[model samples]
Structure formats: C-alpha cells, structure tokens
Target: MIGGSGHVGARAARALRRLHPDLPIAIAGRDARRAAAVAAEVGGPTTATTADVGRGDLGLERGASFSAVVTLVKDEASNAVKRAQADGVPHIAFSDFVSEIGPLVAHHVARPTRAPILLLGHTLGGAATLAALHLAQDLRSVDAIAIGCVVDADDRGGPASQADFERNEQIGQAALVLQDGRWTWARGDAATRRFADAEGVEQVGHALPLMDVVSLAAATDALSIRVDMAARDASTRGAGHATDLVVEVSGRLDDGTAARLRYDIVDADSYARLSAYGAAIATERLLGLEGGPPVGPGLYHPESLIDPARAVARLEELGARVRRTRS
Candidate 1:
C-alpha cells in the first residue's frame, strides 16, 4: 500500500487485513513514522516502508518485489505506475482525476504491462459503477445511465481526500459525459443535473469528470452516461453520517419493453470508508483471493474484473445497504 498512512488508507489496510488475514501487507508513505503507526494498528504480517514516487523504483530496494501495489495517493509523475509496470506487479491507484490520467493511459498503451493495471477513480473507487451494473443486470440493451453520489456536508474525508477535492476544484475540469455515443466535455449549465436522492427528495448535482462515465459507456454501450456529485447536510435525510449513491439506468428489457431502473447504495459510515471497501475489493480481485483466477496483464476498469453480484454481497457485508428505489 502506498500512501497508507492517511485515514482512508488506514481503513483500506484494515479491510484488506479482514479479507486476507495471512497476506503480507506493507504500508508505505513519505512519513515513515506515520506509516509505521498505521501498520502497527493493522497488526499481522504488515510492515511500514518509505516511498518516494519521484523515483523510478519508488525509493525501494533495487530488487524488492511484491504481489501487488495499491496506491492511495496521487502520482503526478506516474512513477509508481511506471515502477509497477517495470516490476510486473498488479497495481491499482485511487487518486486520479479524469484529466490527469490521460498520459498514464497513453503510456500503458504504448508499452503494455505484463501485470494487470486497473484504473479505478470512480466514486468510491468504482463501487458506484459496480452497483450500477448490478442494478442494470435485467436490462437487455442500455440506452443511458446517470449516477449520482450524495455526500454529507459534515463528512469531510481524510487529508488525502480533502487534497484531492481541492485539486479538482482548482483544476476546473469539465465533466466528461457520453452523449449520442460520442464522448463530450460538458460545462456551465449543461453540467448541472437534478436527481432524486435515496429519500426521494430532489437534489441538485453538478457533473464531475469521474471515470464512471467511461467505464459505464464501455461496459453497457450507453449513449448517454454521466456522474454527478452533490453535497447535503445530515439534516436533509434526518440522519447523521450517511452517504448515498443513486444509480439510474434506462434501457430495453428482455421482452423488448422500454424500462428504467434505479437503486440506491447507502452507507452509514463516511464515504472514505466506503471508498476503502472498494479498494479492498479491487485488491482481492486483482490478486484472486476470492477463489478465482487472477487478472492477467493489460489495462482494465474495475467493472471488467469485478463480479457485480459478489461486489454487492461484499458491500452488504461491509455494512452498506442496497435498495431498489424505482422501476
């Protein structure tokens, strides 16, 4: 684990430990003392190491090796990914914005890695996309998909998450949406969307450049796909500490009937925990800890590798509730 000293990273480490008890884990960050503290908290065969993504080898020993490298911090230099590719270790990073990932994608395309490199920058690290797929399983042909993530105003995540949030604001990146089978960048009024929350209350969301649009479009061939994010106070739902993901899909059924479906994945904990759960699930899939074949080399999205049914089950096990809201 890289950047494994922050709040979300600590949760992710615990989640991974819960799922794989005997697995050897490493908590790496620039602050060795902080990383060691988190590693001690997780217990078991975990260790703490210093990392410098500015280095090609990630500041590790010349011949160090690992089963996988999960990154929680942003690698603007792409050095972590480059090291992973060079080492042929499966890798997944959670802190990538749509605009910043293009060069990394291009680099992988130019020289594909021998180990699976997953791009999982979606809401909750691709959990929202997985839930959306599970909800659309009954559909025969998907025409459109709109994903909304409502975060509680009081639920400011860890330092890394807050930093990422600020970066998104400063970047002022236009939302990436699929429209009429063509990918488009939406801005201004076009980026604003109104949707129903889990409680059926109207909520205003602004389009965000999340990886969900690209993954959903590729997985379902949806002509219209976008993900919007909104922030609401706890009082809005008469509940403190709740984050919800609303997935709405419109398409044709197996009977050739037009239909629309919606589901809500509500987590009583903070979005940071939900996101950590997602990262843990992705790590398991990448390493084949769930009694399946490990993912092979090449680039991939979480939807391609994760089983929606299994993912939903895991989410429920992690204390997240999924409910059908509309039919």
Candidate 2:
C-alpha cells in the first residue's frame, strides 16, 4: 500500500496483517524510520519503502508487481492512480475520492487494467445505508437514501484526512442533494437538524457532502440521495474520553415507506482506523473471490462491487453497532 506508514495507513497495514498473515505487505511513506516502525508493529517481515511520488517508479523498484495496491494517500490520489494504470496494476483508493475524479475513472475505463480499480469513496458510507442495504438484500426498489455521519469537531482525524476535509470546506462545502426528484445544491455541513443518536438521545446533524451522494446513488440506482455529517454538541464534549461518531442511513422504499439505520460508536481512534478496517475488508473480499476479481478493469466504489451484507458484517466485526428500523 502507498502512504502506508502514517496513523491511518499503518493501522490499515496492521489490520491487513491480522487478516492475511501470509500476505506480503509493504508500508510506504516519506519517513523510512516511520515506515519501518509501522512494519515492526505488524510483527511481520513487512517491507518498509519510501514513497516519493515524483521521483519515477513512485519511490519503489521498477517492474514491481502486486495483486493490488491500496492507496491511503490523500490529495495525491490522481498521481498514484495514474501510476497504477501505467503499471497495469489494480489500485484501490481509500481517500481523496471526489466527484472531480470522474475523468480519471473514465480514463481507467478506456485503458483498462488487469483487475478493476476500486475507489471506496463511500467506504462503509453510513450505518443506516449499510443496514438498509442489508434489510433490502432482496434488492427491492428504492428511490431515496438519507445518509449522514456525525463527527465531533474536536475529533480531528489524521493529517491527510484533515487536509481532505479542509479542501471540501474550501469548496464552500455545498453538496448536490436529491430534493423533490431533482438535484439541488445545498450549502454547508453545519446546517443543524435534530435527530436522535444511537442511544436514543437527541442530537444534531448538518448536511455535508461526502462521496455517498454520488456512489450510493449510482450503485443502488437510487433516484435521490441526501448526505450530512454531524459535529459533536458541546454537551457531550468534555464528558467522554473516547472518540465517537454517529452514522445513519435512511431509505425511501418503493411503497413510499422509509427505512432507517443507525450506529453510535464510541472509541473510534480516528477516521484512519475505520478507513484502515474498510480497506482490509475490501482487500479480504477481493482476495476471496473464487475465480477472479469481481469486476473487470474500471473504477468502481465498494458498494458496486462488494455485497452489502458482507461489507457491513465485516464492519460490525471491526467495531460498529448497526441497528435498523423501517416505517
């Protein structure tokens, strides 16, 4: 994995080791010491490599080969993706996935790879969305999905994650949401809306743009998709020492009914940890495919390639309490 020596990437590397003990894993980063440290943590003879994206060979030996490379590097995603395409290697990106990457995805489709490129922009999206998908496993006709995540303002993520978050803020944080059967741009992730959290305690959420709006809609064929993220309320701030986040996904069924899912997790180390788990899960699933990779040479989100049930089941195993309700 590229950029696999940081807080998130390292954790992901460790997770990968736990899941695939025999798998040869490598951790790449600018700091060779740090990469070596993370490799040591994995307790395997993992390779510690430098990652200088610009210095040709992407900071690795030429003619290097792998089943797939999972990129946790943010902002530099396009470059890494380009490198993967050039090497004809399958790539899975965990961050820096935005709508603007459309062109890169299209390019991959035209050029093709030995295996499909998976962009997990909506990695595990929201608890509700996953739970809803598990409930709708029959592939029922659904028209809308209300998915949002609650994050604590004080709960800052890793450096790369913070940078990615800041970039979205630079864009005015307006999200394209499905409203009344049409696309409407909404402003900001701080517009508060009242909702009960996982514990049935009232909480607030602000609409925020995450990749769920794009990938979820496309993957599920949902005509409408709404996304938001909640920042922690001061009331619960100083009271707890654990990191926490609330994720919800609600869907409009064909019968005009609504189904919602919720998960309140306390003790999330960082978004990086969750992302690492997600990457590991996807990797495990991909490696487990009977004949070959699920989809052929093209860019796709996890929802499109992974079975929802399998995906969420793994998430729970990794530490997420998912609950579902329909009305």
Candidate 3:
C-alpha cells in the first residue's frame, strides 16, 4: 500500500490482514519509521518499504512485484496511478478529497487499460454510488435521485478537502446537480431533506453535487441526480467523530409505479477507519481473493465495478451499520 503510514492506511492494513492472512503485505510510505510502525501493528510477515509515491516511480526495487497497491494518498495519485499502469500492477486508490481524479478518469477513458484501476472513495462518490446501485436492482427507469449525507463536523475533511470544496463551490453558484437530463447549479434546490441517523436524531442536509452526482448519474443513467452532505451537528460530534451517511434513490418502477429507496449508514469507527475498511474490502474484491474473476483492466470507480450487495456486506463486516428502506 502506498500510504500505509497514515491513519487510514494503518487501519486498512489491519483490515487487509484480517481478510487475507497469508497475503504478504508491505507498508510503503516516504517515512520508513512510520511504515515500519504500521507494519508491526498489522503483524504477520509484513515489511516496510521506503517508497515515495509522489515520485510516481514508487521508488521500487527492480523486479519487485505486488498483488495490488492501495493508496491512501491523493495528491500524488495522478502520477502514481500512471506509474502503476506502467508497472503492470493493479491499483486501488482511496478517495481523492481534492477531486483530482477527473483528469485521470478522463485519460483512462481515452486509453483504457487491461489492468483494473479502481477509484474507491467513501465520501461524495463511492458511498452514494454504492447505495444507489444497491437499490437500483429492483428499480426501473431511474429518472431522478437525490441523496443527502452528513459527516462528523470534526471530520471537516481536513484543509485540503475544505479548500477543494470551497474552490468547486465557488466555481458555480452551487454544487453541480444533474437535473432534467442536464447539469444544473444548485444547493439543496430540489426539496427539504432530512436524515434520521443511527442515533435517532433527525438532521437537515444541503445539496452538494459531490463526485457521486456524476458517477451515480452515469451508473443509473438517471437524468436527474444530486447529493447533499453536511457535517453532523456539533452536539453529536462533541465526544468523537463517527460518520453518519444517508442516501436516497428514486425513480419509476417497471410497472409504472413510483419507487424510492432510502439508506442509512452508521460507523462507530472514525471516518478514516471506516474508509480504511472500505478500501481494504474493495481491494480484496479487486484481487479476486473472495472468489470470482477480476473485472479485467479498466478505469472504474467502485460503483461501476463492484457488486453493491457485496460492497455493503464488507462495510458492515468492518463494524458499519448499513440499512436500506424501499417503497
């Protein structure tokens, strides 16, 4: 893993160990000490690699091979992904908070790969996509969809993530929501939305066209789709930050009936821990360790590639509560 030293990386390494006991793992990062620390925590025959993913070449030794490389870093992923493609290694990137995966995804679209390179994120894109897809199996004509999510205020997503959100929010009057088969700029422009979290607290949310706006739109071919997210209220996060994610999908049924599916997600672990679990589960799926052949080489987000049911199961296995309601 490229970012095995970070919080998410360490947690993910531990999860990966639980999932794959015999799989040799190397915690790779720029700092040997940090990498070694995480490797020791993960136990097993794990080793440390003083690899600088920012360098793109990953500072690998000649002839070194790996089953997969899961990165917790984003800023360097653009180059690192290119390098992984060159190295003929499968890659699974943790969510890019900076939203820089567009160009990378675009490039892959232009020149598809035979090696699966997945962009699996927990927020914005990945979570909502999974929720929508899971409900999509029984729905027909997904004409419209709206999802509202809430994270712990403490999770503010860090400075880089905030900067990115502000930058994107400023570029348009509101987030880029899909409406009437076209992109529209608005924030919660559809309706008043409320989310009943695991704590039995009802919270209001705003519409923000996060990455899921695009990925979900494409995945469901829905003409109208939007995602709204906010930090869980301060009162809830005062003690510690646990993520409270909610999603809703709506459309017409094959029998011409209206249908909607609402989802709730609660994870006791911190956001990074939840993300670590997600990344590890996705990595296992991609590696085909749990069975089934790989999806073959291609640039894909977790939603486009992974089976939604399986994905949900993995998240719950990692101590997350994911429930859905359909009507």
In model 1, which residue pairs have backbone atoms overlapping below 3 Å? none
Per-candidate TM-scores read 0.93, 0.83, 0.84
Where is model 3 more than 4 Å wrong at Cα?
Answer: 97-99, 106-111, 121-125, 157-174, 187-200, 206-209, 237-241
Best by lDDT: 1
lDDT of 2 by residue, 287-306 (tens): 65322354456666666556
lDDT of each: 0.85, 0.62, 0.70
Q: What is the RMSD of candidate 3?
A: 3.4
Model 3 TM-score relative to the real fold: 0.84
lDDT of 2 at 317: 73
Q: Once model 3 is optimally superposed onto the true structure by TM-score, how far is the C-alpha of residue 44 displaced, in angstroms?
A: 2.0
What TM-score number comes out for model 2?
A: 0.83
Looking at candidate 2, the ten consecutive residues that score lowest on lDDT are 123-132
In terms of lDDT, model 3 sits at: 0.70
CA lDDT, candidate 1, residue 144 = 91
Residue 52 alpha-carbon offset, candidate 1, angstroms: 2.5
Q: Quick one: best TM-score, which candidate?
A: 1
